[model samples]
Target: MQKNKQWNVKGAMRLAGTFHFLHSCASGCLLPFLTLYFRHLGLTATMTGIIMASRHMLALVWRPISSVLARQHDKRRAVVVGSLFSSASVVLILLLFPSEGLKAESGRCNASQLNANVAEDGGEFTTLENLPQFNATVYSVYNTTVVTEQSNDDDTAEYTPTPLISNSTRSVRKVRSLQEEHPHSEFLGSLKVMDAQHQMFFLVLIVTGFWEFMAVPLEWTADDGLYEYLDFVDATDRHRSAKIWKQLGAAFGNGGVGILVTGLYCLTGTTAEFYSYAILMILTVPAAALLPLYLRKRERRTSGGFKALQLVHGNSQALLCAVTVVLTGMASSVVSDFLLWQMQDHNATETHMGISLALAHFSQVGFVPLAGRLARFLKYHGWLLVLAVIALSLQCLYYSFLWGPWTVIPAQLLAGISTGAMWWSVESQCEDIATPGTEKTMFRVFELLSLELGAGFGSLMAGFVVQKFGLSVLFQGTALILALWSIALALLKWKIPRQRRINYSRLLAADMTEMSESDSDQEKDWLETAMDDSKQKNKWTMDKPSK
Candidate 1:
């Protein structure tokens, strides 16, 4: 029995690891390249910002609604599978949208008609000058025509007669007539092109919004379901081990797809990012379906959100942590949304971006195991957060001075501390303060809500800044903001009294006591009910003698 139980545990871990790996693979295939794809469709920086911001903002609404519906219906697995499938389907729909059609139309319209007209004139300028329709002397230089109109009063008109030009100006007179007659038509044509581009922009925006709507619930549901299952199996300690698989999967997916796309791009001038994303997502459906569903009975707590707010409000450190998280999210969003765009502008290939991102993920994997030791060395998670923010500020400052695409590669190494360690510290601190039953609520409020809000606002701000001042200014500005914010956090950490700080050991003791008391009360109730049943049976037996 012991051996069989151990085998089941191993099997469950393997199943979870597989699911996380595939899910991360699907995400890495497309997400990093999504902004580049938007650029391929000719979206400006401002328009791209709007789309990205809208997705994050809408996620704030969709996440909770999806959570509630899934819980009420008890369909967490169904939700995960359906969300993945739907997200894949959305990618296919995105492919059907027209790309660069307006630009193509404008290109065709601007083609030079002068060459054909000159060829038809038989290379004879004298014949063209003698024609009644050619009263003006057209001197064309470099495709530009200077028309010298002859007045009926020859005495008043000044004309400098020169040697006949060569084939270059042969059809200048004819080309000038065409332009004169169709000026309004050309102006109206440009308006139509602009209008078409705008139409395509809005269409892509709507599709992207729907994509986020389907995709937001995936992480929340999958993580929650897996955590609950681990708890049921008494292997909650293995949760972090399972997450390591996710990071490895992300690294492989990102690096592998990067190399794949780079090869394809060279051969065919096309990318396979969307197709790869769809395929990977479809592959994850099976793993997601087979994941363990322990369904531990949980009492519905309507006041979870209220309690979460109260905890943050009552704890000054927790409030500061929330603010720091928001700032971190903003910094992260700015980098994720625009880093590739900047690299592309600097002539960076698809491979360069892919390898850089893979390195970042690898760094994350490396840091996750060391997070505890690092926190201990720093003496507090708050210090870790502050240091992580400082690292991010330095990274952003480095990005602003990029001389080539390759230069950005080294900056990504900082992602380990800036992104991975920072998030770990934030989660650890939040976990320490979270009330036992409201753990999920606290995470949602501090991690998800704050991050999303920061991301949305940052994307919006970045778009306008990039549009007006360029990418360099945007990066430098973000660096400055983060640097100032980190200093403020450090000051707060020093000024706050140690007595007022949250004590993790005390909180753990309280939580353990509460759990024990609840279990004992439940046992007592069961014993009382059993006693009542026995008394009833005895009374019935005693009364049966009369019968």
Candidate 2:
């Protein structure tokens, strides 16, 4: 609790907020643009799906490989190298290829014997009249494809691309000189070119992923640390009492931050001169970096009626968290991108978009604290969960049927509220179900994994939706999926009981000494009552009621 109170308004909290901002901004910028770009390349539906699948596979491979490399080498340098290479590849392709609808650049190679008319003296090989000469043949690789059709020594025809470039998947061609090049001559310089016209396009994806890998650790480290180092210890009132106030304060502050983000988004609409997305990414970094420092710097003990973190991590919670994590594990570019496009289609002006966004974020303010109060809030959590699910279902319907951008904004706003409520319920549910001696670190990982799973699911759905009915059809499909999602969650919500939840958070907190009391006896009693309520919501402990 002391930690929470101190962290509420401090530098560390601000850092956390900043990190969230950057993460969102970076993710938001690319998600909206990448899909639109591939369509521009004239890629077919099958090709697009293949590309999307490759990216997801790469993301899964890259993270673990990157992690292993970081251990053996300098982490920062490795990040820099990966990012630099990724960026350079894009820049190079863009500079070289003029974007005139996939023009093919080609050149012809010819060889002629050099005519050396030597003077009477052997040394005078360079006579003015018969200097060795041959015209350097030049052909526009940009116009015609390579010709491999069999013919006489002087014969050639427009290259009918063989069984290659037909697969339609992105690939770089690498041909080696094994048997045929003349041994005495140096290898003819390779006319390196990609099969597809826009080689720079896929590079955009690589650059984005590389940067995300670089940025993730910058913020997640602090988050991961909280769960690993602090979760179990903070389960008790003695150490955590000060932190609950901070958590409450954080809830409000986070809501305020959401408001601020919306305000900024509105102030600078999508078509404005500024790179709005990039600006958001830059601003978010510092906000997230300082959360840990702020937590450690405060000087006073915290005293207040604050919610306690539940200590018991259970099997159900672990399973849910793990599933969520796996779903979200790979990079989620598709769904995120589709959503932005969906929003933009609704004529989301800069300022108007922010309002919707703020609505979405503001809905989250109370959920976190409510999760903290889970010992008492458990059975009731099911109700909130149900409510959120219903709202989510409504959101999908609204999106599917709504014609105007104006209509969609309201649905988006509803999404915000549903998103917050659902997340909070999940958090609390996990705490309620925690097993004995569950570490803070493990809890944090579990939570993140669930989010990852959700994102991945969204990503998978996005690719198929666009290919099937185009954008208009995609909205309807998204609605149907979300409807299914809501129904499933609602059924599960019915099974969780509130009284049991309160026992877990409430009594567990008291047993652990996490409550903080004021010096005054009356104030102390009030704090005790609040603690009791907190325990009731968070604990779900029904073995035996405290005397």
Candidate 1: segments with Cα more than 4 A from true spot = 1-7, 101-194, 266-270, 296-303, 498-547
Worst 10 residues of 1 by lDDT: 101-110
lDDT of 2 by residue, 77-96 (tens): 33433443343333233223
Per-residue CA lDDT of model 1 for 1-547, tens digit only, reads 2455543767888898999999898888888888777766656778888888998899877887787667666789888999989999887777775454111111112213211122233322122223332323232232222333333344422332333323323444444455588875654443332334466678888899989888888887877777777777677778778768888888888888888876766343324888888999999988888887555356453437677888888888888888888888888888988988788766677788888888988888888878889998988878988989999999899888887868987888888999887878767776777866566678778666456888898888998898788888999999999999999999998898532335545544554454677674564545568888899999999989772
Return the TM-score for each candidate structure.
0.74, 0.53
Alpha carbon deviation, residue 99, candidate 1 (Å): 2.9
Model 1 score (lDDT): 0.74
Off by over 4 Å in 2: 1-198, 225-335, 343-355, 366-380, 436-439, 442-448, 488-547
Error of 2 at 89 (Å): 13
Scored by Cα lDDT, where does model 2 land?
0.41
Q: After superposition, how far is residue 402 of candidate 2 from its true place, in Å?
A: 3.2
